[model samples]
Target: MSIENVKNVAVIGAGSMGHQIAMLSALGGFETVLQDINEKALEKAIDMLEQRMNDWVNKGKLSEEQRRLAFQKLRTTTEIKEAAQDADLVIEAVVEKLDVKREVFKLLDQYAPSHTILASNSSSIVNSKIATVTNRPEKILNMHFFFPPLVMDCVEVVKSEETSDESVQIAMDFCKKIGRTGVLLEKEIYGFIANRLLFALSNEAVYLYENGYADFKDIDLIAKKALGHPMGPFELMDLSGIDVGYYANMELYKETQDPKDRPAKCVEEKVKAGELGRKTGKGWYDYRKEVISR
Candidate 1:
């Protein structure tokens, strides 16, 4: 079915990106189900969405009635079958692991209607890797969203070799309907476009810092002042979570087997220490007190 006929969307995760994507789908007038196996996470996602929409109302970005309507469009569930059974589109934003994602798609194929389109919000893992586990590869594609889906306007719609033209078009149309600028990738590749470029830049930034050629603050400053970026590599990593980049790099490394694709030692150390950036209150720079102090 075309995006115009799609009435329900299922977002299969309640973590950082999934909940926001579900919110975006609901706000775009689709019945949205935000699903997770953890009951507490589903509860937290509902609470977070309420606070976020209320904040938007306070900021004049959304009317109180609009917020209420969006809330009405959303439902959270701990059951995967309940979320996917009737959904016209299912977006997986679970753990960034090939095996884990493949398993999710396998279940999605079992639960979702035959016409449902399955998309992944993976930053690195390509859709083809996960599609092989399912019978509906033509309906599987990557709809990669950047961190903080509400603020990021760009959405990468990646089509695998098995993905149908109609599925790609539907994914792009859905992105536009939800207020995001959709860029369709002609082919599927790890990291799509954004993460490939960002990860390469950040990998080098880590290299420079680890080698004592420059401090992270100096690197960030150079990237901001000289490169004309809104946020420097370190700051961006902190916001996106250091573990994210670390895992993405590892995934790429596994596919390419290129030592260069491996996570930088500095990033490895931070993830090992559990200093997962703003989420954890510490990362390349500590966020416990003030981010400005960095």
Candidate 2:
């Protein structure tokens, strides 16, 4: 269907990206459902959403009435069938793994109405790969939002070879309704645009630190002071989660069999130690103690 016809939006996976996406949809006046299998995760997501909106209200970025109305338009669910049954658009923000995303899309295809558009928030793995498991490939495309969906204004709207022009237009219109700039890519590519550039910069930073040529903090200092970056590569990784970069790198390595695409040794070690990032309180930096470096 078209943007005007999109009355209900379902966001799968209640983790960082999914919940915030549902908030955006709700703020845009759609009946939004944020769904996850874990009830605790769903509860936590709602709590976090409330806190974030309250913070915005205190900062004068959002109004009390707007926050109340947005909450009124949003709901949480544990059942996939319940979330997708009446959805006009389904945005999957599950884990970055291909198999998991494919399964989510397959189930969405089965439960969502035939007119529902399917989208993925994958950072690297293209929606073309996920669409293989669904019959409505023409309605499936990438609606990749950056980290912290509320703060990020740009979205990468990528269309696979099979994605219909109508789907792309609808996705762009939906992004506008939610206060985001949608940059449409006519063809799919690994990492789309921004992440490809980021991967190259992050890869070199990891290499220098791993090789002992420079301390991670020193590298970050140089990136910020000399390169004019607001956040150093390592700090960005920690904020976004080291596990996310590790998994994205692994996916790239698996596809191209490129040794350079493999995750750095330190990333693997941090992930194994459960030092995922701000969420886990540790990564390259320790968030719990407010330490810049481990």
Q: Pick the candidate with the highest lDDT.
A: 2
Off by over 4 Å in 1: 291-294
Please, what are the lDDT tens digits per residue for candidate 2 over residues 1-294? 689999999999999889999999999999999999999999999998898999999989999999999999999999999999999999999998988999999999999999899999999889889999999999999999998899899999999999999999999999999999999999899999999989999999999999999999999999999999999999999888888889999999999998988898888999999999888888888779774321
TM-score for candidate 1, residues paired by index:
0.97
**Local distance difference test, per candidate?**
0.91, 0.93
In candidate 1, list every pair of residues with a backbone clash: none
TM-scores for candidates 1 onward, in order: 0.97, 0.97
Off by over 4 Å in 2: 290-294
**Model 1, position 199: C-alpha lDDT score:** 77
lDDT (10s digit) by residue, model 1, range 1-294 = 788889999999999899999999999999999999999998988887888888889889999998999989999999999999999999999988888898989999999999999999999888889999899999999999988998889999999888999999999999989999999998877787988798788888988999999999999999999999998999999999999888888888888899988888878999999999988899988878874311
